[model samples]
Target: MPVSVLLVEDDEVIRRSVALALERYGYGVTTAEDGLTGLELFREGRYDLLLLDVMLPGLDGIGLCRRIRETSTDPVLMMSARGDALDVVSGLEAGADDYVVKPVDTSVLVARIRSLLRRTTFRPDPAPDPPPDTAPDGPAPLVFGDLSIDTGGLEVFRAGRPVALAPTELRLLLEFAAHPGIVLERQTLLRNVWDYGWDGDSRVVDLCVQRLRKKIGAERIETVRGFGYKLRR
Candidate 1:
C-alpha cells in the first residue's frame, strides 16, 4: 500500500502543490486547510506521516505538534516560512521529527520526508537472552523517578505503563541514565548516541535532545550554559 501522508497547510497554493507532489511520488495524501481541521483529520485517520505547516489558523503548528505528542507517536515533519535557527529549534522543541523551511524544494521535501519516516520506522533487533546468572547484582530495574529503564529488556516504563519511544530517543535516554547528573558535551553525545564521526555536525545531538525532552519532559534534562546537557538524577 502507498504511504499515507497528512498535509496540513493554511495556504491554498502551497497545500495543493505539496499534495500533488506527494501524490505523484506514490503517497496517498490527505490535506487540511487549518490546524483544527488537520488535527481532526489526524484523529480520524491512520497516516504514516504528517506534513504540518508552522503558521496556521486556530492553532499553530508548534501548538498542534505538542497536542499530537500528548497522544500520538507518529513522526511529524514541520514546515515553516521562517528559516532562522531559532525557528528550527522551536519547531524541534515542540516535538517535530524534522523541519523544512518554506519556499521548499519539492525534491528536498520528499527526501526529508523519506528520511524522517525511515528513522521513525526502524526497530532494532532484540538482543539474545542473557544467562540467568548474568543479571546485575542490584535492582532488577533501574528507576528514574516514575520512569523505569530496563537494561535487560531494553524497554522503558512510566508508572508501570509502557511508553512508546523511537529507537533514537530510547538510545539517548539510556546513555544519559547511565551517567545521571553528569553533563555530556554535544560532541560526546553525538559520537556516543548517534555513533557519528567527530567531523559530523553536533545539531544531531540538539535535535535528539529535543525529541527526548518531549518524551521525558523538558524539566528532566538540565542544560549547562555554553556546555551541554545532563539528565537530572
Candidate 2:
C-alpha cells in the first residue's frame, strides 16, 4: 500500500501545492485547512505520517502534535515559514519528529518524509555482540547502566520503565548506542541521522541531543566541547 500522509496547513496555496506534489509521488495524502480539522481527520482516519504546519488556525501545530503524540507514535513532520530557532525547537519539543522551513522543495520534503518513515520501520543491519552470556549471533539489546535499548523492537527503557521517544530521538540514540564512547561530528550526525546530503545546520542535531538527553538522562550522552557528542560506555 502507498504511504498515507495527513497534511495540515492553513495556507491554501501551499497546502494545495504540497498535496498535489505528494500525490504525484504516489503517496496517499489527506489535506486539512486547519489544525482542528486536521485533528478531526486524524481521529477519523488511519495515516502513516503527518505533515503539519506550525502556524495554524484554532489549535497550533505544536499543540496538535502533542495531542496526537498522546496516543499515536506516527511520525510528525512540522513545516513553518518562521526561521527562528525558538520556533523550530518548540515544534520538535512538542513531539514533532522533524521540521522543515517553508518554501521548501517538494523533492526535499519528500526525502525528509521518507527518511522519517524509514527510521520507524525496521530492516536488517549489523550489530555488535550481545552482552556476555547473551546470544552472540543475535546482538542483544543494548544495556548501558540503567538504560536499555531494544534495537530490534525499537523500544527504550530506563530504570525498568518504558521510555516514550519520538522517532528522531530513537534513531539518534541508536546511532549513539551503536558506537559507544566514539565522538560523532555534527556533519556526520546530520547525514546519518537526518539524511541531509550536505553539511546542514548543526542546531537541529544539538536540539535533538538535548531532548534525547533529557529523557534518557543527561549524564549518559557527553559533549566534547567544540567537537561533538558520544555515548558514555
Candidate 3:
C-alpha cells in the first residue's frame, strides 16, 4: 500500500505541484489549501505523514503541528518560503520532525518523507525486551541512575514510568546511550540521526535534545562545552 501523506500549503501552485510529485512517487496524497481545512482533514482522516507549509491562512503550520502533537506523535515536515534559521528552529520546536525550505526539490522531498516515515514507524513485538538493567553482561539494556533504556525494545523508562518519546528523540537517545561518556559532534549527530549531511541543520539535533531533556531530565544529557553532547554515565 502507498504511504498516505497530508500536504497543507497556502500556495495553490506549490500544493498542486507537491501533491502531483508525491502521487507520481507512489504516495497517497491529500492536500488542504489552508491550516484550518488542513487541521480538519487531519483530524478526520488517517495519514502516515504530514507535509505542512509554515505560512498559512487561519492557523499557521506551527500551530497545527502543536495541535496534532498534543494527541499524536506522528511525523510532521514543515516548509518555509524563507530558509531562515529561526523558521527552521521554530518548526522543530513546535514538534515538527523536519523542515524544508520552499521551492522544495521533489526528489529530496521524497527522500525526506521516506526517512521520516522510517523513523516514525514502530516495530511490532520488539525482541521481547531483555531483563531491564545496565549490567555490563554483554548486550543488556542500558541503565543510568533512574533511567532505563531497553535497547532491544527501543523503549525508555524513567523512575519506573514510561517515557513517551518521538522517533527522532528515541534515535537520539539511542545514539548517546550507546556511547555513554563519549561526546558526539553536532555534525556526527546530524548525519547519524537525520538524513542531513555534513553540518546540515545542526539545530535539528539541538531542538531534539531540548525536547529529550524535557522528557528524560536535563541533568542526564550533558553539553560538552562547544563540542556536542554526551549521556552521563
Candidate 4:
C-alpha cells in the first residue's frame, strides 16, 4: 500500500505542487487549504504522515500540531518560509517530528519524509538473553520512585501500572534507563538511540524528552545544564 500524506498549506501553488509531486512518488496525497480544514480531514481520514505549514489562515500550524499531538502519534513534518532556528525549534516543540524551510526542493522534501518515516518505523531486534540466571552479574533494574524499567521485557511500569509509550519514546527511555544517573550528551544520545552517524540536531532529543517527561512524570528525568539528561534515581 502507498504511504498516505496529508498536506496542509494555505499557498495553493505550493500545496498542489507538493501534492502532485508526492503522488508521483507513489504516495497517496490529501491537500487542505488551512489548518482547521486540514485537521478535520486528518480526523476523518487515515494517513501515515502529515505535511504542515507553519503559517495558516485559521488555527496556525503550531496550534494544529499541538492539538494533533494530544491524540495522535502520526509523524508530522513542519514547513515554514522563515528558515530561522527558532521557527524550527517551535515546530519541534509543538510535536512535529521534523521541520523543513520553504523553497523546498521536492526531491529533498521527499527524501526527508522518507528518512523521518524510516526512523519512526525501524525497530531493533531483541537482544539475546543469557542462559537461565546462572549467577547473574549485570546491572540491576533502573528504579526511580514508582517507575521501573524492565529490560528483560522491554517494558516500563509506574507503581506496577504500565504506561503507554510510542516506539521512539520507549527506545529513548530504555537507553536512558540502561545507564541511570549518567548525563548523556545530545550527540551521544542521538547516535546511540537513533543510530545516526552524526549529531544531526539536538531538537529531536529535546522533543522526545518532553514527551517522555510527560508520560513518566516531569521529575523522573533530570536535565543537566548545558550537557544533556540523566535518569533520576
- Scored by CA lDDT, what does every candidate get? 0.80, 0.89, 0.88, 0.84
Question: For residues 66-171, could you state the per-residue lDDT of candidate 3 as single tens digits?
Answer: 9998887888999999989878988999989988898878998888888888767755343444476744343467899999998767789999999998888988
Local lDDT at 227 for model 4: 97
Q: Of the pair 2 and 3, which is ahead by lDDT?
A: 2
Ranked by lDDT from best down, the candidates are 2, 3, 4, 1
Better of 1 and 3 by TM-score: 3
- State TM-scores per candidate: 0.71, 0.90, 0.90, 0.80
Whichever of 3 and 4 has more lDDT, that candidate is 3
Cα deviation at 62, candidate 3, in Å, is: 0.5
Query: What does candidate 2's lDDT look like per residue over 153-201, in tens digits?
Result: 7789999999988777888999999899999998999888887777776
Compared to the true structure, candidate 2 yields what TM-score? Answer: 0.90
TM-score of 3: 0.90
Q: Residue 191, candidate 4: how far off, in angstroms?
A: 3.5
Residue-pair clashes per candidate, as listed? Answer: 0, 0, 0, 0
Query: Global CA lDDT of candidate 4, please?
Result: 0.84
Off by over 4 Å in 3: 122-140
Worst 10 residues of 4 by lDDT: 133-142
Evaluated at residue 70, the lDDT of candidate 2 is 89
**CA deviation > 4 Å runs, candidate 2:** 126-137
